[model samples]
Target: MKRGRLALGIIGALALGLGGSVVALRAGAGETDRAELEKRWADAPSRFVTVDGVRMHVREEGPANGPVVVLLHGSIVNLHEWDDVVPLLADKYRVVRFDWSPYGLTGPDPSGFYSTPRSAQLMDGLMKALGHDKFAMVATSNGANVGLEFNRAYPGHVTAMAFSMLPLERPSQTRKVDWRLKWMLEAHKAVLPNWRHREFWRLMLEDTTPPEFTPTDRMVDQITEMNNLPGALDRQAQYIQANVRAFQSSDVGAVAEAVRVPVLLQWCSFDDVISQSADASVKRFTNTKVDVINYPDLGHFPMWEKPEKFTRDLRNWLDRQPPAPAG
Candidate 1:
């Protein structure tokens, strides 16, 4: 009975501490010396490719001749998010991962513009520049939003879609916002500075990751290093500020409807913010297969949370789908 009480007390204390942290709202860190940051965060399989007029950071692995799978990571995360998952599919499928502007090693957008449409264009052009006319795509978080645009803009080029943390471009679920949600949204905006902080993101990962999976010290350190990439914080802030009013209802649904290839959506059952997108996209998608798998424990990034399980499930799902077009 004492132990149970102690556990409850600890939980309550943690809740209060997190709540206080959110309320405090700290400023994000500025970039350290460029040379130092570049040396620390630039990992293997790195290359620079000129896409359209913009230079992007690319990481290519697996057999060059194999069917290609392009990966788009979540906001505030770099291509390394796919590090574990890459090898799982690399031998059988060529994997291409890149750092989109305003994040990762790619740095800022030269045009000072960032939106789903622009990112979609970048993805399509990047694949083409890599000599891949047709490929499958996997994106997470905001990356999924860009993937929707990619499919909408260049349907012929994408053979399959897999999106985790997919954002649905649909009408607000409610016409009225209660004080709590309104307050929460406002508070989120108020914490804009911390959004650029690596420690904040690290704490988020710890709070969000399921108990079954433990994020190693190395994992957290690597993620923090990426967050501290030179100029990334400023670029990300600028992009978000520019895109405050970006999406309209049906914008994402229309993209989903236009997708003519196999698509898989993986969501966590408890994730109310993004899991609903699976249902939203499934209803809108008509031309090709749209499948959803809900994990009992995983959060937004199931691929990172349960890499092996996610890879196995993905491989099985891909096997069941119509194979990609020949190289």
Candidate 2:
């Protein structure tokens, strides 16, 4: 009995030691990968346009003659989140997408302009630099916050606006993580071993596809690769910690009240991040016939989940708006 107890103690210590080593190794790998990704971004194709003494990374696509539409991605996601949406809209409109300062390939802002108001100012400068005096805006999540602020500051430039999966009010409590993080952390329990979460992946692919089709493996890889960006998770965590109040305190009511431009508020009924109650608040601010489209099957990333439907709906909405006044 004494010998057996001693062996058990030894085994426990060994197990603890092994676990500690594994964690240390993982920490080291994470640091190395993050550095590599930052270096890669150094050579990435980006235009540094001066905005309020800060140079912001910007990218534009499609015809110079086309109407301008600025696409703003969510907190962690860069301009690439709109990759699928941009091509569909590009034929009709010049699509402008950029990593907001301090996230994704854009990296951190050297000028310390990281808040929503500062971001809006940078965006305004970006549009001006692009020679677009007036343009439409489309935003998701935190990007929506910046978009609304930009509209408030420069309503003359924003002709129409579209918002997706955006929170209406500040969360009542702190420490609440975004829906995407919750899903990933939960899914990691089963996903990390195989480096995939089949159910989550399947759902993502199916959501983006048309009603009749399944998404190919390549499509799944394309998305998973984006999510696997080094420091992507860290950057998102930091942004949330630093700016949760901004998201919560976002004056949806104020923006809605002041915005005279056409607006489309697209909310996914099933989204866990931005609650449905938040969507209801938009009506309080605007009677401009707020075009609210609720998708019963979609999640937070609706553009990826239902790309075709999302694009079609967006295009249809844009088509209804009269052309902007020529400068």
Candidate 3:
């Protein structure tokens, strides 16, 4: 066979093998109890609050009157995504984190709304309820999207924001999701619920990382355990689908154009997705006070993979900003 045909054959074989792996590992896979999962993740200031009909898990730290710093995590992760970085800020800033809809201990959305506007409103309410008026935010991936919306809706309330990444340009005119890729994700929504816990962790950690970073077995085990929590996948699937529509709407990118506060854009050296966006953000925010920090050796989750470096860089930026408003 020719080289092109030979490569095609190998690709097909790998795809088939991956499918087989999912099915084989799914056998006897059982869901975990919600109570057990919640018990494991929620601790020390982590508790549930009914925010606009959604019961979200929130954790706050530092003095009740300190400058507020809200940590917003990425997709498929929870408030605890800040576990490595929160301690660094908690001593001085009033650090707050919360489990968003269909992720972490928060569970599904009671309102069935997963768009940026809905999420931004919910976050605003959460801050007000906590007695924080002006605050700073550390937002990653999906959370960064919501953070942009929050800043747009309530510009005065947001003093500064550190974005893991963002795109300043408008989205492509082409169809957002290819039919084949969309079909695969939609099909796996069911398979994911039944798929082996380890497989879920592997797929999530599969990309968006530097080539040499090796996730420990312990890290994989912990993520797998959280993913395998009962009812988690079901809620995950629901939010995933809704979020797909939200992406097409480009609400996050649209909101970015209006953000007037100081922003720290953190970029991953090897990340193919966010670097371009980071550059575009510079152009879009020409009139605003914006700074960039390139993580030369890091990946998507810098705070998780390189907490010391991430927190140090973040502190350098945070310390330069104006003091937080008196509580």
> For every model shown, what is its TM-score relative to the native structure?
0.78, 0.72, 0.80
Model 2 TM:
0.72
In model 1, the clashing pairs are none
Off by over 4 Å in 3: 1-29, 167-196, 247-252
Give the per-residue lDDT of model 1 (tens digit) for 98-160. 987666767566787777788888877788787888778888888887887888877788888
Candidate with maximal lDDT: 3
Candidate maximizing TM-score: 3
Instruction: Provide C-alpha RMSD values for all models, in order.
Output: 7.7, 6.1, 6.8
Residue pair clashes in candidate 2: 170-248, 207-305, 208-305
2 against 3, candidate with superior lDDT: 3
What lDDT does each candidate get?
0.71, 0.66, 0.72
Name the runs in model 1 displaced over 4 angstroms.
Answer: 1-30, 170-197, 248-250, 275-277, 325-327
Residue lDDT tens for model 3, 76-195: 667767888988887888888887666677756667656556778888888888778888888987788778878888778888889874534322334233454455556655675443
